[model samples]
Target: MTLNLFSQFASPYLLGVPLIFVASISPWLLLPSPANRWMPNRLIAIQTWFSKTFTKQIFSPIGPLGHKWALILTSLMAFLLTINLLGLLPYTFTPTTQLSMNLGMAIPFWLATVLIGFRNQPTASLGHFLPEGTPTPLIPILIIIETISLFIRPMALGVRLTANLTAGHLLIQLISTATLALLFSSPLVSSLTFITLLLLTILEIAVAMIQAYVFILLLSLYLQENT
Candidate 1:
């Protein structure tokens, strides 16, 4: 029996819903257990040592915040990385490649950065929407531009991942389908389609990794800006 790739289910929200919960509650999960309440010092020592060694090796210039950031970023990366890679598996879906899922992740990160910036520097956060050295007459226009640009981040993130993955998937499916059809009708066309599909599959793997890294990199940049 032949498999129907298009018949498979691939809902972005369904895949991303759990990721949202995991990201939201990760900090609490990392807190020390109640049994170790009396040994707070010990826990702190362990965490400090781990942070020093790991942070130094992985994210040198960032220091202690690097450790916390690493944990947060890794969690996000793992979730997205898994979804992106899983799409290559038979009968599985890649939620990270979906616009809804990518936007769901990016929007929260953008909002979190904005909220953090506001909490850290309320007045300055608004000022950030304006160009640094603009004249008074052009400040309003610059602010409008900046505001639109700021809001566009999530949209851009969504479109980038979604379009790349969806396009790749469609290409693969077309090649495979055409190959099978040609194999029964014309051998030469079948061979070419097969080769094309093979190359596209390899390219898609690279695309998956690049998309995941890009997502995490943008998130890190946003966090750093707020900090």
Candidate 2:
């Protein structure tokens, strides 16, 4: 449980970065058509018939944008959540618990927000940073605050994810160490520690899902606000 910078750097954490990158961005490359334009009605029909016949087939309830978006978001979530959970396993590292990896994901998302907003509404997107109805004296302060808030999005996103994953991992490690230490020192204490670690493992699974949900929810909210 001693913090070892070199140990972390030497682990497979670095490799997860590219894996996550590919998982997040590969869908765009594979699916060349715009989400809005890509229709799978024929495919859907085939799937629906299969579902009806087998009673164990898959069905897509949403349109192309919704489905593609779901796939993209799920891919991201899977990579990050898997990385986060990996730390629980012996000899594995969680890349998402690292600041660099979290920032890599967050910064791109922030840039995506800006690019999407501007692309959707070239002139009006500026209005998001500077609202129309504002008091004359307060305009400067509002603009400054808005600008700061805009910049803080990525910072918040990165810090929130990294902090959550890091804290969870640290807590698990602490409990695990405590359990090991107590095994020789006190059986009762060791048993309690084991129980706590078990409970925490379950909680971490929920945390993974919650974190994924939060990231995608906030992302969608940002998109909705701008567009």
Candidate 3:
């Protein structure tokens, strides 16, 4: 039997049940609960700081209209961050690596923002499709283009996350295989390959965090447009 480069991306199952649920819920349980303290420990403090900073920064641009989204946005950011980093651990599954799951999360939020825009101000929301002072000939074409782009946002979000993670995982798998294959045949080459693998692992960790931030950031931007 041989290892498949793509096999790691396949969703793991036990008996008849999908493990994604377990993978998703397990990370949250690890978070430390807040307790009475003059000052909390660094971990709790950092988490609190990030939550406040993210909430404030994300909601600032959108003004009061977007304040209601703070809870969902912060929770989503935390969830994504935890899930992504956890995947890097040995034998862990990454739910965000699946386009289906990403899109399932994306579409509803994207649709909600669009709905908010339309619900609050129908004229302004539709105005995004066409700018003021456009030539009659280009108006139709531009509107069509904008509409297409509008709908494409959710797909783009899903694919961006999936592609980045999948590519990184594949690359890591290939490099690790190469490193092992070279270990006996060429010690020097194997050492270099192992070093590269180490660097790539660090880079992947950064990517996991960044992709989560980008996911939340883009959602906030969409809400900004609506609000």
Q: Give the alpha carbon lDDT tens digit for every residue of 91-195 in model 3.
A: 888888889999999999999999999998889999999999999999989999999999999999999999999888888888988999999999999999999
lDDT of each: 0.70, 0.64, 0.90
Ranking by TM-score: 3, 1, 2
* Pairs of colliding residues, candidate 2: none
Better by lDDT, candidate 3 or 1? 3
Instruction: List the candidate numbers ranked by lDDT, top first.
Output: 3, 1, 2
Candidate 2 Cα deviation (angstroms), residue 73: 2.5
Segments in model 2 whose C-alpha atoms lie over 4 Å from true places: 1-71
In terms of TM-score, how similar is model 2 to the real structure? 0.70
RMSD of 1: 7.6
Candidate 1 — which pairs collide?
A: none
Q: In model 3, how large is the Cα lDDT of residue 40?
A: 98
lDDT per residue as tens, model 2, 1-227: 25553344233436455444443444345333323445556645554453344221111333233333444555565455555555556766566666777788788877786787788677887786678888899888988999899889988888888778767777777788789989988999899889999999899878876775577666655655555
What's the CA error at residue 67 for candidate 2, in Å?
7.5
User: What's the TM-score of each model vs. the native?
Assistant: 0.72, 0.70, 0.95
Instruction: Return the top candidate by TM-score.
Output: 3
> What is the TM-score (0 to 1) of candidate 1?
0.72
**Candidate 3: misplaced stretches above 4 Å?**
1-3, 36-38
Error of 3 at 203 (Å): 0.7
